[model samples]
Target chain A: MHALSLPTWWIHVASVLEWMLAMVAVIRWGERRGETEWRWLALAMLPALVSAMAACTWHLFDNPIELQGLVVFQAGTTLLGNVALAAAAWTLLPERSQS
Target chain B: MTVVGLGALAAVDPSPLFVLSLLPYLAFLRWAAASKRFPPLALRGFQFTLVFVAVTIAAAVVAELRFGQQLADVDRLHGSAEAFLTVANLLVLWGFSRAEPGQEPPDPEASTTGPSGEQVLSTGVEPAVPPEDGASVLDPE
Candidate 1:
């Protein structure tokens, strides 16, 4: 908290909120279109959101040396999130179009 | 044997995770780019996430080299990296938030053709009469 500047905190918080909103928007869009697969896209966004929250939490604590493990956790989640998002997007394509 | 601080090792070794993440992200970009039905704005938004990753990596490297600090400890660098992610999320939200043209509900009063070739609608309009010259009436000469 004290480690990050006011503007830095603002960016962190806004990015998290935007991500959550995007997930909800994706879910709503899928439901509207009657495409159930979009829910998986929203699901795939979770790991990234968790990663963002973990980073923010680490900063909130001023990046304590003891809690540095959060950094690695963030990285792991980021990797998982990227892979999940890719899989979800791939599934959204028609089978005929999929390589 | 050399002693290593697990936390420090974990912190510094996240480069492996970052590198591995790129493989799936590239696959996603390829698929999204090829899919015609994928939302265009959302695809751009997805691409921006890669930009965010690249910026964050560069910022992290700079934090290590210039200040001998982790990116999270460098407030300005961290914030700048996050701003790209915020833009990416905003674009994704904007892309999916709008009602797609095909997703609109059919209007109950909209005209439909009947089995007998008559228009079926509560408030129907007459069909357009074709011109004798076999040209569309709305066509400009």
Candidate 2:
């Protein structure tokens, strides 16, 4: 049985970076327009942050069995983040476009 | 002798469970990316994410079914997955970075002009301020 992997860390770091970039864009636009949608966009990254922290914790301990348990947690976080993204998208109400 | 060390030496292997769970998410991402209301860059970044993750998940399924998790094969497959994920993340970063800050998304039903040229109200209108003097605004001066 294998423990956590580098790809996990890779995805998390990249995701955080991605979220940071998007957050900057959202904040710039959202503040001026009073759009609450950006809040959902920010919240969407919650799982990524949690996943990154968990990966670090697993790294410190280096336990494969423990990691097996942690996989569920990781998956849960992924679900959370993805769900938030979905919500953010919905809040945007893409069908409302005029131009 | 430690799997953690081995994992560090290797990469995160995709599990059947993880891969399958993401299927619905991938569907949602596909839909979101196609939506017109949001910035194209952000949605396009999301599209990149969808492809990369889907690629890895497909690879994992194939590797499991055909290769049976043989050590060497698993290593190759996991490495391949990581490579794809790296590209995916980079695309995500690039796509989002392309978005211009503070640009309002264009509305499909732009402000309409009345017969007398008065403009129709737009979305996100501010609430009417309460009357400080307790007088009805509807009353004409």
Candidate 3:
């Protein structure tokens, strides 16, 4: 909160909101196209979303020494999210080649 | 003892994880680039996420070396890194939204009539039937 400037907070909040919107939009687009596999893409987005939240929470606490654990959690989730997203993208390829 | 162990683990540098994430992301980029059917803009967006990681790492290094502070403690550098992620995400959303079924240019002949006499385009712009009650919110019309 007070740890970050107003514009910084705006960027943080907006990125979180935008990421959620992207997940929802992707899921809806998949459903509309009758592609059940797209749900995996949405599910894969969760780790990144959690990572963003952890970053925000760490900042919200004013980056206290006690909550340094959140930073490690954030990094781990970011790694998991990247790997999951890669796998999810691969899932989209097979069906796409067919259509 | 448990608290001490947890604190020690937390104190371990998390930077290595960020660096390691690049390996999988590069693999993702290769797959996306090779796939003709993958949304082009979405592919670019994914690539830009790599840029975000790079920028964040640079910013973190500068924060520690120049200012003797963490990236999070330096608002401007942190915000700049995050801005890249925001752009990357927006591009992903835009690219996916533009993605139609089959990832082909629209053909007028691709439209077929539903049982209710409404037109359903194979492009995926229109649904064949209205979603029923209790359908998942992910069902968009």
Pick by TM-score: which candidate is best?
3
Model 2 lDDT, residue A18, Cα:
58
Candidate 2 lDDT over residue span B29-108, tens digit each: 76565554355655666666667676666776877788875222354565565555456555555544544332325542
Best by lDDT: 3
List the global CA lDDT of all models: 0.74, 0.53, 0.75
DockQ of each: 0.47, 0.19, 0.47
Q: Model 2 lDDT vs. the true structure?
A: 0.53
- Checking candidate 1 for backbone clashes, the offending pairs are A1-A60
Q: What shift in Å separates residue B34 of candidate 1 from its native position after superposition?
A: 2.3
The better-scoring model by lDDT among 1 and 2 is 1
* lDDT, residue B28, candidate 2: 55
lDDT for B80 (candidate 3)? 88
TM-scores vs. true structure, each candidate: 0.76, 0.58, 0.78
lDDT of 1 by residue, B27-51 (tens): 8788766544456677788889889
Q: Candidate 2, which CAPRI tier?
A: incorrect
CA displacement after TM-score superposition, residue A44 of candidate 1 (Å): 1.0
TM-score of chain A of 3: 0.91
* Each model's Cα RMSD: 8.7, 10.0, 8.0
Q: Please, what are the lDDT tens digits per residue for candidate 3 over residues B38-127?
A: 567777887888888789889999999999998889999989888898899888888877766545334332222112222244444445
Local error of candidate 3 at A75, Å? 0.9
